[model samples]
Target: MRASKNRSQKSEVRSQNPKTYEIHISGAEGVYEDAEILKIVKEYTNRALNHPKGKPDNIVITLEQIKQIPQKVPMLPVITLKCNSPDKAKEMIFQILSDIGVPARTIKNSFKILTSPRTMRGAAIILKESGVRVEPDRERGVRVSRLGIEKNTEKILVRKLSKMKVSITTVKEALILASKVAAYTDVIAEICISDDPDYTTGYIASKRLGYIRIPNIKSHGQNYGGRVFIVRENTNINRLIKYLEKTPIIISGDIN
Candidate 1:
């Protein structure tokens, strides 16, 4: 019985065809140093191989250090509107989206989501004559879709923040991501409402208008906020999403 079991195990190992996956890992120097991260990876690989799902299939992870040539794209210029009241801010947002060819009905529907407390994950509304539909990526904060949109990894973003000479903050990161989405081929415009109770400001970004910030888009303590990406007609949703989420896009020091 012992000899037969040994033979079976050997046969299984020989017959197994291991699949390989190349995962790129990056991080800021101080926050998650390379050596420390590699250790974490090693630990996780062992945990995954022993996971309770079933008899673990073999998984081998290899890391290669490469000179990351980050694509430095220009940051959009800021165009702050002198609107303080939430109502006025709302009007301005509507007018801007309407001017950019977003249908009146779609704009209305999007605003509904922006104001709703339930839309914590935000949404991507595809513009089509047939009808507008919302796509959600709840698991991942708001990228194009589940495929994952690659905004700056914290490391790359930190480097860009230094180049731009700006204070690093979550709001800044959101704006940068918005700018990249605006530059995409089928994306007509983008609107972002801050969920922070203290922050009543929001912005709309697009290739045509740069980044337009509107203060008091919502009242303080209102607590509801989200993003809306107004995409163009007949867009290859999956492909556009892949570009938005997977491509390693970074913002440059140059503005406008």
Candidate 2:
């Protein structure tokens, strides 16, 4: 079997802020034993930590094991959440964030990004968990992936997923990743809407609220959904990225 592993790191910006890093694992199309996967993760993570940049403040790991199924599963109906007015929907969303300790200014900006027409595909918004930018400008929120989950705090996630009945190994793996991100030093909360055309639900996860599902966060046939992560200022962007790409975290706790 021909399998290839890749590792690389880049700065999120040239400024003095702590740089963000990414370590990606791909090009493997065959199944391997669990011990083998763990070995790969440890070996790479050690290399990253030993680099000249020094040890990262946090670490997270993701393993996307690809598999093919012969048949397609049917899509479920969109979970519709009714509201009395247009603002009501926004209010409810804002309330969830507020209840979970997201700053007032951050909440407003996150909502703008979520509803904005310019929100791009294949990307999520990253904002300071404690800032007060008057508008939802790009500087206020960066369009990036793998940052919110450190692409969303990993700790806030485990509590949410731990309560669910996740049978699929992939789903459980994802939940563990989110949990790890939420637990980082600077991370605080995360909200996500699936970009899948067939899926219409979204979720808000934090250390306080656990995982609360929003039944109808998006519309069927619409593919504009995304994720938002709120984190503390001056967080090391490079260190966070390294964790997301390099760490190999196991699916802990009882996943029934």
Candidate 3:
């Protein structure tokens, strides 16, 4: 009877371990530096150590930055510290782990942050909480989708751009514009431009499609990204016109 019970326990353990998941981590826009990211990771690790639940076994850390390369590295659950700069932090942590005889590796230019090791209570707790289900599509994918910008239009446009075979230059410009527009409105707007000698014609085409090109607005600043101008909810055109005429117009989308 004792032998049978031990076998059952081993089976349960095998069933609970999931092979992989899509994980990401990022700091508040403009607030994320290597040091800040390290701090967050350290805090998470410490909390896991003291957690009443089990501790995580193997951890993977991925660092992400804009216009910069990303880095991925393995981490030790016990001795690793949190990082501020994702790159430097992960490198330092990896070095420490290596000194202590932990196996680890580092990868560069990763598009996403790391979220792994189940964080405290070990694999058993993670298996319980995550309900350990295996999907064939979960492995070895790009890390670009981890950044959660709330606008739906931006998401759609980004997806659309990813499918096309456009030149990198055009794609870059489109991504910049799409990101700026997505900041203000929930509607996903899309743009497709053909090679045209006359820039005015292209501008006219964009305007005809209800996309008003923002002029003199910095890409990252307020007041000049893609903004939606609408009057109000349940308001008639005449009332909207009157309001626009009388008030300093601040046009957001259909405000509830």
Candidate 4:
């Protein structure tokens, strides 16, 4: 019996393939000092592999020593908007930092504290137009279809926050951070003013830039500062250099 069990175990080891996960790690903004972070990640990865109380069965992990990564191809310049928010400018700072495009895993649990309702009123309106009946369930506080009921509970409403405008002072700080993010990522993102004229000095440097803050319209805010634009006034080499240098930041976290 013992010999038979040993043979079976050996066969299983030979037949099963090792599951390897590839992870890329990068950080900026003065958070970690290399060795400390690498060690922490190494330990964390081990914990992930052996999650749920103890070491997992039939698993092997191999880690590579720290090595230099290759040069990065420059991404397009991101158009950055001056930040303004109602709540002590924290929102402005968050929007600016979001442009850095940190990997999603890092931010996944960050918003868990929020438990707000998600509304589908806009979708309900569209469905109503399409001849589909959308009924509101006051008990559940959500919209539902005539045939199949849809409900929302314990959800966060992100749209409502857009109403709060950031202060002008925060906008300047966010602008600096946005510039850094754009230069680092090499992707030019859109910059939308807060519908406040005070931001003109920050974004109205060129006529190619325009204002349209409608959230319902598909192309409303898309036409703002972005990758492709003609610089009409400056033809000199110095002007071109200056323009190239001031790449705006688009948050890597979102497609927009």
Note the Cα lDDT for every prediction shown. Answer: 0.59, 0.46, 0.26, 0.25
Off by over 4 Å in 4: 1-163, 166-229, 243-256
Candidate 1 C-alpha lDDT tens digits along 39-61: 75765565444432222344444
Question: Model 3 segments beyond 4 Å from truth?
Answer: 1-9, 12-31, 68-256
Instruction: Sort all candidates by TM-score, best to worst.
Output: 1, 2, 3, 4
Residue pairs whose backbone atoms clash in candidate 1: 148-245, 149-245, 150-245, 150-246
TM-scores for all predictions = 0.62, 0.50, 0.21, 0.17
Backbone clashes, candidate 1: 4
Off by over 4 Å in 1: 1-69, 128-131, 134-168
Predicted candidate 3 versus true structure: per-residue lDDT over 34-135, tens digit per residue: 557767566545543432223334343445454533221111011112333434433553353344333332111110112222111100100111222121
| lDDT ranking of the models | 1, 2, 3, 4
lDDT, candidate 2, residue 111? 67
Model 2 residue runs over 4 Å out of place are 1-89, 116-125, 129-174
Expressed as tens digits, the lDDT of each residue in 96-185 for candidate 4 is 325443223222222211111221111111010122222232112121111100111001112222333433323322333333323422
Evaluate residue 180 in candidate 1 and report its C-alpha lDDT on the 0 to 100 scale. 69
User: Over the stretch 1-256, how does candidate 2's per-residue lDDT look in tens digits?
Assistant: 1112222323535556645432221111112355577775765566445433234444444565534321111111112245444355567778866776667888777766666643332224355665533224442233222211221233534454455543232233334434555655566676676544455556666545554556567666654555576766666666765444444433232222
C-alpha positional error of residue 3 in candidate 1 after TM-score superposition, expressed in Å: 51
